[model samples]
Target: MRTAQPRHYLMCRPTHFDVVYSINPWMDPRKPVDTPLAIAQWESLRQTYLSLGHTVETIDPLPGLPDMVFAANGATVIDGRALVARFRDAERIAEGPAYLQWLREHGFADARTASIVNEGEGDYLLAGEWLLAGTGFRSDPRSHAEAQEFFGRPVIGLTLVDPDYYHLDTALSVLDEKTVAYYPAAFSPGSLAVLQRLFPDAIIATDADASVFGLNAASDGYNVVLPHNATHLIEALRERGFNPIGADMSELLKAGGSVKCCTLELRSAG
Candidate 1:
């Protein structure tokens, strides 16, 4: 069933949120989040999407890779093309099949995945007339040029510094066609300057708040999932004219994600 709106987003449930152990190199793994807590958190966030009047399709939770819910990071749909992403990690390597099947069934004639190993949605940001893909942490630096060749559109690469801001969506958000929320630190200085030049009016969220991963915590055209108890940030967003909503994403955060990572905006699959 198609949604009445021009866009429909997708998300998955978390089966083993606590099973995610992001360490061995330097990433923090503050013990595993209890499984029941993860389910409750996912449900709470999912309810937020439903409340926004979006058509939500819930998928089974995949173990090990708790971040599987944020499908857009692995693949993006735009202008009827499914740009499958190359995952940088082995865990998310097998996460593209379902999205491809979705493309085939939804009537998209042209579909392809990037040949790199960057599986982070935060690394890719869709903007006016171009796709701004990020590099540094998860995405390969070369994918930018490759994506440009494949899509025929200029694929500008963003600067990625940390795993926390591994995807472009983690630091960039389109509040509307004209306005956006950004955290310059998460992106390359060059990308930041270019984005500012292109969208001077786009709201640039403070770097401190960007650390919360809430900069990407926006969707449904009128809502945002703020970290629980971020009253100041929430009020600041409202001050900037956002209708910030609440979702206790503590469990998802345990797996290094938030509201944005838990959903995929399926825009015009046909």
Candidate 2:
């Protein structure tokens, strides 16, 4: 049986959620946004974590920063050390400092902002002893070295090819310390080869599921929280003895984020 380990996560409420600007392919300002529904969906995701025995911390939402609700882009926390993001887009530049300040005041003494453009966990994901860093869109390749030095981990650089899946979290998710689920089409040929070589048993997602941001998930070893519409992934996860919990982030999808996008894992030294 797969045992679930409780995790600590950071999230932001979508109090001022809106889709006024386009940064990625998923964002289309022409579409109308339902802020109330977005908030409800976000709350459900948070409650799901709590029900699964995880600790959740919140940061105050700043107005005019609609994307701030996608807290995973805020910072990457490992061993209690936070390397806050330096967003690539001018629209989110202020977010880096805001997240850095929050971490500094809220017990992460080692928290510091990144020098290069790296969109926090949006481009950086921790899987076991390695840090899976993504580039090609929102993050700079140079930030890979910066992350390695800050977190003292072996960082493997992966290049994203699909504009729709601009962030690493959007294209892939770490299911546990060893396993991962990813959309092969979202990565470059070299990145795909690296993923296959590293995680031979990784769960591969279909275009149907990947398009729904189903790969944008969070797992506590056993329970995998993902989009409900990803039927194939849910079945595959169940076959692997994982408890796949479905979440509805359709409203947040307008802003190019979902479960994993809204979640920032807070790791501390064992």
Candidate 3:
């Protein structure tokens, strides 16, 4: 893989991260969470992005919104326009306006609320010119059509089937402009075939990698930011000529998210 121009990302400080509610299958309210460790891990991820020459911006983490630390679910920024999420879960409903406000306050002049239920970048991933929209879980398939009209980009809707892989980000990752990595079992046979037809040379991750959220990674064409436990994925990326940077986000995994969940791309308009 080759290096591309550094990208800008939006992040939220894990000031109040805790698994207070069980919205996803990964969340366990009975398990004890270490808040300080979570903050430290999140900071390490921020610093890693900075080290790789990427810009990192922040949104204020509101009290009582534990999942706010997973900033990638807040909104999808492309060409300086933000399609803010309309969360499917009531617990996360407030995040829609909160993120839209942050985007507007920042540089996203075109930021607006999404009509259909969606989970922002967690469901809608930008892979080069294509917008890969994940449905059958947190995001509605209708939002894909809306996103196509809003961004004027081709949107491919893929339906997810596995309960553990509730969000597309949990099942798939855009490795570079032309390549991707995904868990084939996470999607329906039709959706898997569609992805295979689209990305014939895409990397196929094993169950082990998918279980650790290895597919939930952020790549800059040259460098991939992923969880520390995904050793196989790191080796795989290295073999493909891309540098793999690892950051421990085990504490945040209690809420069913990892490194990719903590970062949202802020693409330029031009």
Q: Pick the candidate with the highest lDDT.
A: 2
Candidate 2's residue-wise lDDT over 32-92, tens digit each?
9999999999999999999999999999999989999999999999999999999988898
lDDT of each: 0.65, 0.95, 0.91
> Residue 7, candidate 2: how far off, in angstroms?
0.7
- Estimate TM-scores for all models: 0.84, 0.99, 0.98
Worst 10 contiguous positions by lDDT, candidate 2: 261-270
142-196 in candidate 1: lDDT tens per residue? 8777767766677877686655666677777766555677777766677778888
The list of candidate 3 runs beyond 4 A from truth reads: none
The digit string of per-residue lDDT tens for model 3 on 188-250 reads 999999999999988888898899999889999888988878888888888888888887888
Task: Supply every candidate's count of residue pairs whose N, Cα or C atoms clash at under 3 angstroms.
Answer: 11, 0, 0
Error of 1 at 145 (Å): 3.2
Q: Which residue runs of candidate 2 sit more than 4 Å off their true CA positions?
A: none
Q: Which is superior by TM-score, 1 or 2?
A: 2
